[model samples]
Target: MTAVEYEENESKLMRKAKENPFVPAGILGCFAIVAYRLMKMKNRGDTKMSVHLIHMRVAAQGFVVGAMTLGVVYSMYKEYVLQPAAAQKALEQKTALEK
Candidate 1:
């Protein structure tokens, strides 16, 4: 095979081989946005003295809390887990190449 064809195939293999766990994390974030919009729409008629106002406030607070928790967890997982693992992999590759 030509050099260009070999490089192209190698890249395609790499692309398919890498499993990005962050894609689901991003989808979770998008889901939160959708949920927030839906909640707002559901409580659009809530007024200062309406019983629905309290429920709306509670729902919004819950959403905020949940979103914050998810963000913290995702960030901690990426920082404490994913990054180190990737760095170790790179180090191993470098060592192997130097051998």
Candidate 2:
């Protein structure tokens, strides 16, 4: 078989986004919050400004990490819990039909 390339991978990602709409929406919401906070900050350059900037950086990083963690957990639940349950139901139907 021929090897698949990057476009194929990109399409797969698009397909996932289509399947799970909330994942992208949550990411966008996180970015919007960060942008709003940054835009609303006062024009200052003293120590307080430095500390405030650091806090914003940390908050943005935490938001990104939280989004990633939620995505991973949701993916794990779908793969381990939902897929098996669907497969088992299909198998049961097939066995019943054969009998």
Best by TM-score: 2
lDDT string for model 1 (1-99, tens) is 422233444664344223333444444555666577556665566454455556555655666566557666876988799999999999999999999
TM-score of 1: 0.51
Off by over 4 Å in 2: 1-26, 43-47
Q: Highest lDDT, which number?
A: 2
lDDT of each: 0.61, 0.72
Error of 2 at 81 (Å): 0.4
Clash count for candidate 1 is 0
lDDT of 2 at 88: 100
**lDDT agreement of model 1 with the native:** 0.61
For the record, the alpha-carbon RMSD of candidate 1 to the native fold, in angstroms, is: 9.6
Candidate 2, residue 23: lDDT: 62
